[model samples]
Target: MKWITHLEGGPKRVNHAAVIVGHKIYTFGGYCTGENSREYTSMDVHVLNTITFRWMKHPISDLNYYENDDILPFKRYGHTAVVYKDKVYIWGGRNDRSSCSNLFCFNTTWHCWTATKTSGDIPLARDGHTAVVWKNYMYIFGGFEEESDSFTNAVFSLNLETMRWTYIQTTGKIHAYIID
Candidate 1:
């Protein structure tokens, strides 16, 4: 395993999601425990410059539209994120309050978030799903829905160039190859 030098101001708990671009690590939406209280959602965005290993608060901006307003991925955990071209895409995750199936993208050049729309075969809302960029397509697989808390093995792909979705079937357990 490669050793990743610890970055500062990151959530200490496991399962929180994040994405990295260039040298800056951007973390938005995570769950953390409050002082002698229950777990709570976090909207704080943290930016860390990998080269200098410095951390700072990121400013929010309107760059994307969903439901006629600027859309930001809410505080979530177990979400999946990927970077394509110059944008970072974030997908479904769970939180103390709810689970999400929304998708949002961050434009590195513009430094803002934009919501993506798909026309057909949208995957159900889930958390812990894996999103990976294969060539020009974004492949998503396996996540648990909040209502069921049950893990899934569904595999789907999105053509980023065309913005379309294609569902793919697997022969065996999805976790088989995913696990060692």
Candidate 2:
């Protein structure tokens, strides 16, 4: 494995979500806790070019608005992001303060962020959840919920075409974690 180096000019974060589209890795939401002491929950977008081995800041908006005029998502970690077609879907992550279940979408084609409205039984607020994309659906399972001091065993599915959510009930292979 090759160690990725020289990402110093961009955001320094941990627990950030990263997904690759084409030849680039798009990183989202991470906390910087060392000397910089920065919290990057609802911050900016950064890109790492795998081919060139360089890091660059990406614009997360269209040409219509400036940073002072647009609204974005909150800062979070342990969130999951998946790329399907031309869009990147961002869901559930928590920061030092709170957890949220809101869904945000960044259009790679348009270079804009759009808040998504989901239907059906929405999952509870969580972090560290694992999300996987298969075909046209996104499957989400288990995460740590700080408010209850417990881990989750629930499964949720989101339809990419319809933008709807559904809680799936299963009897086996339920995702869970142990707390001490």
Candidate 3:
């Protein structure tokens, strides 16, 4: 494969999650260093059209911006995101203070965010994890546990159809590593 340089209009970020859907790549939640030498976590959603090689920020509604609005996700970094069907599922990221266990979904077709309600054995909130989708399941594997102040080797899965989480027991020895 060859690497090609493209236009540079997108936001400069680190530890963000990027998922490809159709011909575009969608990036969410990461921190960027500001001019004052402070790190600011972002909640903006940016999209890159592969063919056009252009970047556009998708305006997402702010939390509690309207009456009876759904809870929006916080600005975070080191999150994991995966696409299941037309929606991009985001989970497990941390801000300056702490990590999160919430799941947020972005409908690619509608361009809207939905705070997903989950059930069953949900894993502890974490950051720097990896997530992938396979056969209607989103598998989350290994991240830093803020409460324990250590990295974890745990594995969990969420069923897309049922929205239920289940801890998966493995047999082999798998080392845990941070994904960002």
Q: Pick the candidate with the highest lDDT.
A: 3
Candidate 2, residues 1-180, lDDT tens digits: the string is: 896665466677888899999998888867667522233334457888888878887755222233422346666678899999988999888767778787888787787787788888888889999999999999999998776878978899999999889999889664569999
Clashes of each: 0, 4, 0
**How good is model 1 by TM-score?**
0.78
Q: lDDT of each structure? A: 0.71, 0.78, 0.84
Q: lDDT at 23 for candidate 1?
A: 84
Model 1: per-residue Cα lDDT at residue 18: 73
97-163, model 3: which lDDT tens digit per residue? 7788989888999987788999999999999999999999999999998889899889999999999
Scored by TM-score, the top model is 3
Clashing pairs in 2: 41-75, 41-76, 42-74, 42-75
TM-scores, all models, native as reference: 0.78, 0.81, 0.86
Assess candidate 2 and give its lDDT: 0.78
Q: Residue 5's C-alpha lDDT in candidate 1?
A: 81
Model 1 agreement with the true structure over 1-106: per-residue lDDT tens digits: 9867865565454566577888888776655666221233234467778888888776662222233344666556688878888888888876666777767887
* Model 3 steric clash pairs: none
